[model samples]
Target chain A: MSDLEEYKTVIGLSFGNQNSSISFTKDGKTECLANEEGDRQIPAIFSYQGSEEYHGVQAYGQLVRNSHNTILNFRDMLGKSSEDVTDKKHKRSAKPISVNGQPGFSVTVVDPETGAETTSKKTVYEFTVRHLNRLFESARDFLGKKLDGCVIAVPSDFSEKQIEMLSKASKEAGVPAMQFVKESAAQILALMYSDSALVDKFVVVADFGATRSEVSVASIKSGIITILSNEQDLHLGGEQLTEVLVNFFAKEFEKKHKINPLTNRRAIAKLHAQCEITKRILSNNTTASAAIDSLVDGIDFHSNINRLRFELAGSSIFNKMSDLVVKAVKKAGLETVDINEVILAGGASHSPKLTSLMWSVFPEQTVIRSSASSATPLAVNPAELAAVGAGVQASLIAEFDADEIAGSLTPDVVNAPHLTKPIGINEGDNFVVVFDIETALPAQKSIECVAPAEGGAYIPIYEGERSIKVTTVEADADESDFSEEEEPEEIRERVVTPGTLLATVNIADVAPKAKVEVILHLDAEGKLTVTARPKDGKGSNVRGSN
Target chain B: MSAGKSIPLFPSKTAIEASFVPHAKVSKPVVRSVEPIGPYFLAHARRLKYGRTFSEDER
Candidate 1:
């Protein structure tokens, strides 16, 4: 066995709507390799010249050309309703999606065994896992050896339930265990690792990728980093930067080549990619040039963009993010003086315009613009920052070499089951006023309201999504869900009071989407008694003694 | 004691059966006389006589 294969290497996987990548780490140093042939990325591009499957770097290289059939950026569909995706990923969309069915983007996958066609409706979670699993095999092949545990990077907004599904997929991939790390957190760790000196102070790490531009404020205290707030997006990133470059090349072509290259998808795909790389290089450099297209018989097209002018062309893009940075700074409760450093971390964060903008924004602070740590450095090419963080998380997993690992952390890490205190507030349609806490009383008050449903009623006292908007308090008022049998000829007058709340029982919004029960009691002497129990009536309730 | 007591309005079981149960037997055909009833319906009636029976002793 090779020395590199002697020690089992952990793999870090990052799957996104726009891109996917994997990194292998050994002895703590990571090499972010291209996941081609479905190794952390898609190699199969379905088109006329048979099926062109470009693995890893090649797949990324063919992104714009095969974007018509290449499905990326369905990351948002991980645990969401289908209605949310049809509006976005509709080109290769073969079927109408809905939330009630399985979640995520619907994609076509031909069974290898039978060659039968099938549309696999994978939830965002499923798609991410499937991609990760496919990448693992490719990674294993690349390594020419058996695989080890994995560290999977999850979106910052992914809830625990989605994490649970990801963990299950990893288990099926024969990865003994997996760890969940946030993209921003991993990127932050990767940046800190690559650029050594930024550990002393609070820095603003900006990430710009194909889909979105996000800014986050974080502080590294004694090498232990803390992310203060969630990421902010201006909805502008390298994709727009590429689009800007494409438009520039298109407009310049009409001026110089006298032909529109946008008419052909393949030709446009090849050139748009060249433009995307040129735009990224212009972020930090003076100028970059690329061949545009061919005109009449012998003429070849070339375009050169100056850094200063290209920045001007995408000025609105930079301007859109200015407020977001200010907002993030405000939310972080840090002033420009308080910000000791600024580090660029994403693909577009390498843009010279953005770098100069960062320098201008924080003239008082030290700004470190390092290229090594940016996640998708150039052309969204090989970068291991997210993968490195995932590897670090994987190393922390207890089952590095265990033959039979016990109690996989993957399940608990992603979907830690929690029991919400069953919200047991008496929630029959009738207001069963056991004791009104609203009444300012030395002596407690008790009033009984009618049953919600007419009949010898059964009230469940439901436990989720309940918040009562108290328009005005009614001291002696009862207006609730009507039952046909509870009909009285005349409506009773209700006296309205200030601060009287109309309460509906509901559950706490958390993983498990739990139901809670709140049981309050009143002593004959008018002291309030309380008990908190589970929705299943299996636990003790909280009692208010005083 | 008053809540727990069971009523025994009729004096004897034989007299009650002769008066009420036999009358039900006699009026059974009379009640069905209004309908175009089938004999198979009588084969599987609500109160059966031939098989395993239930009594107060069983209760």
Candidate 2:
């Protein structure tokens, strides 16, 4: 491979209700491709096809026409326990949540022959990972070469655990190394790219998508974005907008054709789809038509939906997400004006009224759409920016992984994946001694703690402030950083006490194994007297008092 | 009290716990590692982190 070819390539990924994308960088240009459009966002859509199965856009369309075999909005509902959302059954005809194939999420699926049941069972992570791996493989194919590595973009709100699942899924997708990017951070990046001042700037991004509404304000500096406040409603988004419009049209049907819209499952689905489309239209246009097909009462309604009314039905929800945007700004202790920019992104951000509301709320700031064009991209595409950022992160991380193998001066520290508590500490978990409610922790001050051993045992220098988190500390004598103040006048006959640490074994073997012997060094002040033998070979650690 | 009444300035417990060992007449105050200065973790995070990520050449 050429030098440029040797530069590790990483594929950036982003996924949504019905689509997933991949982007790759080569020769200073990046390429994007949407792998799953006609395909089901999650192929687990037909996992339990008792007799036959329906899938892809066909299954999506079948949702409205054939109620017996269709599920929608099942993606976002994953990972949530049933107790968290019992009403999910009403929203999705078949809840697709599953637990070990227990139908955690259900979707009604009509048997191609029987047309009896339209539901299957599986955990959200399991099902979603399966589909995600499939989608990722398709994205991998876009390169037309063997896979290199994958960078997966996860929702900003994904829990640490979710990221773990993402890691596993990425591995299953045949990508060993994966990096994470917050969706909001990615949007903020695209928002920043549209303008460079994004570094050291504060901006609120209201990501209103088909199934989720997330509001986050981030501060960018030195190409790093600090997510300040993140609040989102996984259960809320464009779906609610569609629901309100569905109800409005249902009422109109009752008045114009004397037919209730909800009596027929097929009609409800078709109407929901129609309302969703019209809602998007009304986001910009003053009005749009909502078309519904009815059978039993021989009724059909094509009603004009005004932008004003659309906002009336779902403005609260939008404003709810907006309220959080305000909080995002507030969390940074900045007013709307303090926000240099506001990013209108996500599939739902296209709402001009929503954009207008965001603008009016922060009249001074530019209410720019993070992603603006259809083909050429008027702005950065917020939807896929996380993927791009993840790719960038992946590339950087790939370099780190390679460099790691090459060896660096980084202090050898213990870190285990899924080890919540690293022997003594946890992953990414650090406690600082700060004076304020939530401010930067000051430089760690050395403090003394005792284990209260039976006999007089010598004290070993402990590194972590939190008892659960211990770090390896270099001996002060070995470090050049410490300089001696004039030696304290030694007290005559002070005498070494029996409790003195005769020897310290610093390095130890893993649990369930023998511990490595520790070498000891002592100082007059009774500082930690510890050292370690080189594990590889015999370079006997020197032991004596300094 | 005699003119040369001997008095211990510090309790042996403090000295011993300070990592001092007993010596004959006029025991020298030998210092060990830095007590207060450290990259200290309470229980020891490094032992765990290093134990897994990097295998000892012995392995």
How high is each candidate's TM-score?
A: 0.55, 0.60
Model 2 reaches what TM-score against the true structure? 0.60
For residues A1-546, write the lDDT of model 1, one tens digit per residue: 787546655677776556656677666565565544433444322221123333345545545544543445555556555554454333322233553565544545556667666654545555456556667877787777677677777666777766776678778766744466777667666555545522345667666665676677765432334456556562566677777787787778767767776765555666667887787577557889978445323456787889877878889987766556667777865565556666565556666566556656664335545463343232223234566566655544424344222223222211211111112223233223222111111112112112222111111222222233324333332442444343433322222122222222211211132222333332222233333333444322233332
RMSD in angstroms between candidate 2 and the native structure over all alpha carbons? 19.1
Error in Å for residue A27 of model 2: 4.1
Docking class of 1: incorrect
Against the native complex, each candidate's DockQ, computed on alpha carbons, is 0.01, 0.04
**Model 2 alpha-carbon drift over 4 Å, by segment:** A1-5, A16-19, A27-31, A36-56, A71-90, A96-103, A106-120, A193-199, A370-378, A402-546, B1-59
Stretches of candidate 1 off by over 4 Å are A1-9, A34-55, A60-67, A86-127, A142-144, A191-200, A255-270, A281-285, A294-300, A372-383, A398-546, B1-59
Candidate 1 residue A277 Cα shift, in angstroms, is 3.3
Reference-based TM-score, model 1: 0.55
Error of 2 at A421 (Å): 34
Q: Return the lDDT, model 2, position B28.
A: 29
Report how far residue A535 has shifted in candidate 2, in Å. 54
